[model samples]
Target: MKKNLKRIAIVAMVALVIAACKKNQESAETAPQETVKNADKVLQYIKDLGFPASSIVDNGNEFVVEEDILFPKDMQIPAGGAGTKIEQYYTGSIVSATKKLNIRIFVDPSMTSMSSEINSAIAQWNGVPNSTLRFSIVTTAPYDILIKNEALAAPPGFVTCGQAQFPSGGSAGALVRINKTAIASNSFAQRARTICHEFGHCISFRHTNWAAQGESTATNVPGVTGTDALSLMNGGQCNSGATVLSQKDKDATAALY
Candidate 1:
């Protein structure tokens, strides 16, 4: 009788352990599926914003579109869906007015060598008349953005000067990855332009010449339209684009902010 009781207890204990293991296994399986599902939603959101399918690259953890704009897998999708105007384009999403007044940039140690360039870029935005947008550098935590040097890769015959994520959740894009080596040969003005351009992305400016870049049209800031050959916000002209914001650029800035 005693032996039977002990055997029954052991069997019950083994059954409980098995059930717990099965439950954990099921949870582990579901987590990846959930992640994949969320990623799909983000991808769809990107498409809905008018980025052509061919322009979107699935870069492991995030989608890289139009060479410079990054859409992270976990970024928050806007609550009401993408906006609809198309020219001198914007993402429709933007940094909230309150947050725009003091967007903080944290320079990673890897990027300290380009501090002058970063400051120059920040000054360009800060100096925009009739706009309250500002960017200040900080040395500690609690920052809105992090600018860092990264050895970005590219396909043959092409180069990636830098990359910036777009704004989400009512804040600026969180990361800017500068390919210092790639742009090292560019002049100081051009380098600063690269940084400034990425900052534009952080605050929700798409490439001003999106149509020429072979991208789908994007939301246009009210009263700021048409091609801007000298627009600093133009992409694919990293080493040769406008180093300072153009008149229309300022107009758009004033209009949006």
Candidate 2:
């Protein structure tokens, strides 16, 4: 009888342990209310931006894109595209002539700490002496509105999410919209890298298309060289797998500024 009782006790303890573990797991999986609400906002933004509807997949706390340029479930992207590089047609004259301009970052409610990060990014640009480009933050409406206004005077499709200036030396603007949930999910370095990458786009950079390691991807056309891993404009992983800016990016931006 004692043997039977001991066996029963062991089974009961095992069951209790399993139950406790499951409860702990459940708690761990549950995100804070703010995080969940923010994630929903990001999804709605993505939908408004016109990403492929089929790509949206809910993965618990955030939405994830499983194929063809994976995006986090919590990010709202108007257009999903990798970065690219373009030849600067207008040279020294235009670069020297373009005036210091203002750039406004329209923040979606989902972006938590964008203001501080943006200020720091602009300061980085300011460090370049004699560079005509200058930027300031404007929090108002759609960033695209500003892009459209600037685009009107720009080269034909010149101001893209890829590049900064038009061929004519006209100043363009970049608009950044970030997802806070996605930011927290990633390391700080990775998040910063992504911010810098987007900043590069505002300045008119293309994805690094340079070929190395036997990796050859088609650029827009035969003549155009796409950005590569070493190039800050490239869409590949950066910041030690976190997406930080490349040295090339600093050089390129410094050249402009």
Candidate 3:
């Protein structure tokens, strides 16, 4: 009788362990499915914003569209994602006025060599006449954005100088990755332009020449409509783009902020 009781007790213990293991396995499987579902949503949101499927590159964790704009897999999608209009275009979503007043940037150690360029870029935005948008570099924790050096991959016939995420949840986009080596040969002003351009993305600025780049459309800043030849926000020009914001760029900055 004693032996039978011991055997039964051991069997029950094994059953409980098996049940717990099964539960864990189920949870593990469910987690990836959820991740995939969220990624799909982000991909759809990118499509809704008028980025053609051909221009979108799935980089495992994010979508690199138009070569420079990055849509992270886990980013907060704006409610009812949709595209609007053109001319000095915006992403429809933007950094809130209050949050735009002082967007803090933290430079990672890898990007310390470009500190001057980063400051130069910040100065361009800060100098926007009558606009309250500002960016100050912070060395410690709790920052609104992070700028770091990354060896960005280059596609055939194109060199990616930098990449930036877009604004979400009422704040600036949180990440800016600069291909330090790729743009090392560029002049200081052009280097700053690269940084400045990526920062533009952080604050919700789209490529000013979105149409030319095959983007479906983008919402224009009020009263700032019309293509801008000197706009620093134009894509594809890379190291050859404008070194400073054009008059229309300032107008658009003021219009939004």
Best by TM-score: 1
Question: Least lDDT summed over 10 consecutive residues: which range in candidate 1?
Answer: 80-89
User: After best superposition, candidate 3 residue 189: deviation in angstroms?
Assistant: 0.4
What does the lDDT come to for candidate 2? Answer: 0.43
Candidate 2 residue lDDT tens string, 20-133: 878777575455544666676666654443434565666464443211122333333223222232241111112223344544455444443555555555665555454556
Q: Can you give the lDDT of residue 107 in candidate 1? A: 100
Candidates' RMSD to native: 8.2, 16.5, 8.3
Clashes of 3: 2
Error of 3 at 55 (Å): 1.5
Query: What Cα-based lDDT does every candidate model obtain?
Result: 0.89, 0.43, 0.89
Order the candidates by lDDT, highest first.
Answer: 1, 3, 2
Better candidate number, 1 or 2, judged by TM-score: 1
| Cα lDDT of model 3 by residue, 1-257, tens digit | 99999999999999998897788884667766677888898899888887788889999988898888898888887765754532378888888878998899999999999999999999999999989999999999889999999999888888999999999878899999999999999999999999999999999999888878777678778899878889999988877889999999999999888
* Whole-structure CA lDDT of model 3: 0.89
Worst 10 residues of 2 by lDDT: 145-154
